[model samples]
Target: MGVLLDSFGPALWLVLSPTNLVIMVLGIIAGTILGALPGFGAAQALALMFPFTFGMTPEAGVLFFIAIYAAAEYGGSIPAILIRTPGTSAAAITVLDGYPMARAGKASRALKISLYTGVVGSIASSFIFLFAASGLAWIGLQFGPSEMFAVGIFGLSVIGSFFGDSPVKGFVATGIGLFLAMIGSSGFSGLRFTFGQASLLDGMPLIVVIIGFLAMPEVFRLMAARRGDDPEVASLGGENREANHVGLKVMRKLVPTMVRSTLIGTAVGAIPGPGATVSSLLAYSEEKRFSKHPEKFGTGIDEGVAAPETANNAVVAGSLIPSLALGVPGSGAIAILLGLLISKGIVPGPLLFQQNGPLVMAVFAGLIVSAVLMLVVGIAGVRVFALVARVPRYMLAPFVLMLLVIGTYAYHNYAAHIVIAILIGAFAYWLETIRVPVIPIVLAFVMAPIIEANLNRAMVIHGGDLSFALTRPITLIILGLAVLSIVLGFFRARRARHESAAAKENLGETP
Candidate 1:
């Protein structure tokens, strides 16, 4: 806590500098554009932009990416409002009220509501993150190897449980990631799965794997999608143009909904799974339940839009809590952020505040600035973002592919990395086709080394006695949590499947 206070001044200075501020604005603009495009999102944007950050100072890069992250959350609602297409998964809930509002000639109102609440949520969430992350870090500092290993296991279990409709598939994907992580030489054991390739000596490059899974597959999905004219965005109605500005009264009225949603988002995000998508869903449902006119939620109301939008944006900061404190990324986009930090030789976790206090503080400051700037940028360039949404997926595909190639190759200037990325990307696309979640794979891969290293250390200290973990209260608690998480995931999956089947059956009988 002292470290945070001591470094915050310098961190603020670094982030507020003119050069870094420019990076923040540009990143917000870029993120907003990409996020407003259907089928593109923060993870893809970050993956594509990875190479460009190589030349930046760590603080600047972190700030830039954080700006993109915050802006993308808001950007996602743009298409949801303008064209009834959710630009990101988190925005799907927004489509409920957003599209209806747009159809009713309230498109501007919906967008502004999303923008304003998103900024407020993000800023508020960042503050929660500031205190919460530091506290988590302090707790983590007390964890031994056994506890840390258990924590890692808990993270993977929770992530797997929440990833897809079926925990089975999610676990399978996690296994695949674990296998991929085992490819390099295990300092104690010789090469496990390198297959005699010298390049495998260092294991899979995080950059290449990240690009393959997050960026390339998106391009594949885009290009493989059936060719057609792009969906046209509905025009902003004349009345909407005349009354686009959201009055302060509307903002005042939705404050409670925004506050509730922000809290929900922060809590859920700190748990290391579910992320903005689930948070938004939960927030929207809760708001409906709390609303005076619940029936009007999907029919288009300010509260409906505010609730989900606020939650999803708040998730931008909330998701970082676990990532910064526990070295466990909450989502794929967060994995990218941690990957960058690692590449810069800045390890995340409890010690990070001690070793890189200023940098960590910079991240916190950057998040706040980005949240504020996202609102400004969103308001100024909304029309342009709406037009960008009209771009054909096919046209965007080639450019994205080019970026995938360039970014992958630039990481190490290794041609093999490009080939590996292509193969992994193709594999990822196949997995997607089978409804297998890719994010669990990324999370597990990122966590594998940490888990393995800690588990090995724990074993060495305990003379290979697994029973020692049973004696450690912290380790036992974490392991118990992991078990509970898996159980919960199984039930959630079963319930989701039942609900889906029922919905389909009802649809079939409707007409």
Candidate 2:
């Protein structure tokens, strides 16, 4: 504790240096713009900017990535609110209420809420990173293969059934995703499903899957839909000036939601593996469950926008906890940052503080500073971002398609990825046409490798005895939580379906 406190002053000096500050601001600006574009999320942004960090000092490079990482979380909400297109999968929850709020002539209000709550969540998370990263990382270290497998199962339960009315379709989608993840070489087997292509040897990249299933479908919809100018854009032109201001009364009402979501985000983020998306989904569900007007969650409510935005931004700093303290990358972007640290010959582990306290502290300081800068830049650029909604759908579709192609190709400079993305995008579009949820597929794909490898190792350790999980307390607890999550998700989906049926009947539509 004394060492951490002592390093704070030097950390501040390092972060506030002129070169670092410039890198911070530049990274934030670039991140915001790229994040506002569908298909170009934080991971993609970091991957694109990776080469630029080669010439920078380690502290400056870390600070630069931190700035972009935090700002992208805030920037993703911009498109989600104004156009119903989430720039990142984590921002998908924001679309449920953010777009509806914009339709109610309060686009500016929603943007302000997202900006403010995101800043609050990020700041709180930074403090957690500064004070408890090592402690949290130590807790993480206690998990063995079985515990991690159970954790992966718990994550699946939290996300799998939340989408689509039919649980069967969700299950099928998840099965397909797991199957996709199983392609590529295995330690026990030479090769399982990599036909003749060398590219499939590594399996499908998550970036390709994300772009195809999530972003490209939006592009297809934009190209196909024949809507006029958006109401959000018109509202921006003539809405009341005060609509942009989130006053004290509104802030007070949102305090509890922000607090709850911050805790959820930070805790989940420290666990590793799809933390941002999972945290946002969990926070949104929790807020809806806790609200007196639970049924009104997707109907342009302030809390809906606040919950997920806050959680996703909080994930930025929380994700760094494991990366800095345990040498474990919590997400794809953090993996890139971890690579940077390794390239710089900075090892992160139990002895990291003793060996590299100053640099780690600088990163801690940079997280908070970048969060504040995100708020500033987000507010200043809101008007310009809203202009995206005003672009003709015809023009917007091709531009977004161009971005999808470029981003996919840029991921590994592989042409095959572009073709695969287009194919998967078309398939995903067809799945949406049948009302099957894609969220389950994405969550399942991301978790499958972790679950498989961990389960395999656990089995090997226990001599293939499955009963050992019941004897391990932590594994039992996590599996219990997974079962509970599954039950809750089932009920939630059932209630939502019933409400949809009732609403349709009230409007004289067929069931």
Candidate 3:
């Protein structure tokens, strides 16, 4: 309590400062614009902001990035509600009902509800971070290399959810990603998959590959399919003005749903894995299950938009709990933020609050301010951003390509990196045709290094004894869970196959 009181003044003063306030609003504006654009994400938006923040004070830079992170998460729902296309994976669940509402000529109402819920969730989650982060930091310090390895495995276990339809394809995609991660040289200075290319020494540029995998395929698909007509864009201008505003009565009814989804989002985010994508989906599912009229869920319902939008946007603050309290990141965007903090010499752990108390408080203050800014900016800009839906594929495509090119170059400034992005983008585009989404691959690529490095260290610590690595209590528990999950997943798959075959046989006999 004393520490909190001491930090309050510094936090408030920094937040209200002329420079930080201006930068925070600017970051929110950039975040909303980026989030409104399909295929753009918080990590990419932060990457774009990186070069600019490089010269600022640590407080200023961190504040700018935090605003962007919070706002972008909220921003993703804008496109999702206005059109079927979700701007980020975090907003994917919103499309189920948001687009439906838009189709029903209530795009403005959907956007307003989304903004309202986003701010509410953001505030709720921030309170959790404020009060809980310190306590969580203790658990974070207990992690060793072995424990981290186990955590990575647990993260990988989410492959079942990623490939809920076909475990084989999911594993295949994961294998591809792991193989890609192994491309660079060993710590002992031996090359693995370089194939004699000098640029391969660094393995692959993650930013370039990510941009390529996400952007190129979509671009190629758009060009080849010539998505000449987007009815949502044309229809936005014709939405009913009277139905555009969400009524006070309607807002009152969604209060419970908002609270429930915020709690779910905060819980999901506090854990090591199961990011915003899962949070929003779980919230949406729970909302539907508990609704008096479940049948009305997918048919332009306000609760549908509210639940997912609230949950996902809440993930921004919820995710920060782990990132600030522990070195472990909550999501890919947070992973990037982790790297940024390390580069700037701001180590995150139990000691972070003790050592950098004011900075931490400033971040908390920034998050609250940003949430308010996101709501205000979103309300004012909804009509303007709705204009994005009307953008022709021909115009949007070239502009996105240009941004991708620039983003890819911004990483290490290597020309060869740009070429690799081109090749990977082209490959990912073809991969999509086979119903193989690149998400599993991307997720695996992100974790492969963490798993490999940690596992190696754990073995080395125990003199190369595999059993010795498994002896620690935390490692043992996590690895046990990972093994149990894998076994369960396998059994479930077998059972599903058997049931499917029996159903097929029965259908054949019935005919």
Candidate 4:
């Protein structure tokens, strides 16, 4: 206890420094702006900023990125509510009801609810981080290659469960992502895929692929669908002011949703790959299931805003578990962070905790501070940001596309990457039109390599006995859970279909 307290004290002091606080504020502001803009995402922001961190200490750089990540999640709600355009993929769930509320002139109220719920959820999840991180670290240290592979499989399965209404589409996205991930050189034999191009030798850059799939295509879509009209922002004056004012009563009402979503977010975040989008969607669905008036969900209820906002923010803390402990990135942002850590000579594995205990503790402290800072910044700037929603898509779209191009090229000074980003963006937009969820693809891209590497290692060690994956008790338990998740999802889908059929039957009878 004494040693732990001593370690924590210095970490708290490091983050409490005025310089660090200022950086946190700047990161949150910058991230919020990027998140509010269309075609910009947290991953791109991190990739762009990653080079700048080369000069800073690992602790400071990591903290800066965490600040951006946390703020971006909250910032996404701005565009989601105001324009029906999600600033981040995770914010897509917010648009289901948030845009409706905004159209009804309750944009201010929706923004306030999102801000408050995000803060509460972040704080709640940080506590989970504080308590669970060390234990998870200890457990992760014992995982063999086979166990890790199983964990990766479990993560991929979770993605299938969390994506859109069609499980087949989710699996298809995952398969494509995994196939794309295999494009680079094979880790074992040094053989290359789609051989012949020098650029293909190093395999596709994760940044390039992510940017292509997520950012570039959105730019073209925005341009093609360009509308001159601006969205209306709810003013803070008169009745809107009264409605927007967040009070104790509102907080109390939202508390249940916040708590539930936070729990769901933490659990999903703790998983290996699905990250915030899955967590937010799961939380949103759960909220709908539990709501007294489920019909109001997509009509812009505060509960709708609160549930997803809270879950997304909570995911920030949860993602850190695997990254900090086992060197596995829980999400895209964490993957970037892992790369940054590697560049800084900080290898993140079990040894990380032993060698960099103080630094690890410092990061944990910084995460807590970032959460608090998000709340402060979010509340103070809510009105101004809400108004940013009124910016015309015509103007915003071009600026976002330019930023995407610049950020992509700036990463490796490669113009090819910019082209790649454009191609990916165009493809992603088409995929969206076809109702394919991007989350599974993104997650599969992130996890497939890890899974392949670990599985190959495990097989070599066990003389090709694949059963080693289940030989370990913990791995078996995880696999069990994965199977259970599939079963549950199947039943849930069936129940939803039955409910829809019954509703139609009742309507027919009434007519």
Query: Which candidate has the top score in lDDT?
Result: 2
Runs of candidate 4 exceeding 4 Å displacement: 6-20, 27-114, 129-134, 188-203, 206-221, 224-247, 260-365
Q: Write the per-residue lDDT of candidate 3 for residues 60-161, one digit (tens) a residue.
A: 888899998888888888766754545676675677678788766677888889899988898888787777765544554566678778877865665533
lDDT of 1 by residue, 1-511 (tens): 7668788899999999999999999999888877775555688778878898999988888998998888878887886776554557678678778877765666777888999999899889888866677664344355677876886787678657756547899899889888998988894587888788877888887657666765567678667655564332223343446555687887899889988999988876775645777678668867875777754766888898999899998887877877887897877889999999998888998788788889988887898899888878777765664443444566667866776677667666788888998899899989988999776776677667767887888999999888967999989997998898789878866876787799999999998
Candidate structures ordered by TM-score, highest first: 2, 4, 3, 1
- Which portions of model 1 show Cα errors greater than 4 Å? 1-118, 129-137, 225-367, 461-463, 496-511
Local distance difference test, each candidate: 0.78, 0.82, 0.75, 0.75
Q: Supply every candidate's count of residue pairs whose N, Cα or C atoms clash at under 3 angstroms.
A: 0, 0, 0, 5
Model 2 deviation from the true structure expressed as Cα RMSD, one decimal place: 3.5
All candidates' TM-scores?
0.61, 0.88, 0.73, 0.74
Q: What is the lDDT of residue 260 in candidate 2?
A: 98
Task: Name every residue pair that clashes in candidate 4.
Answer: 212-424, 212-425, 216-425, 217-425, 217-426
Model 3: how far residue 67 lies from native, Å: 2.1
Alpha-carbon lDDT of model 1: 0.78
Give the C-alpha miss distance for residue 481 in model 4, angstroms.
2.8
* Model 4 lDDT at residue 16: 88
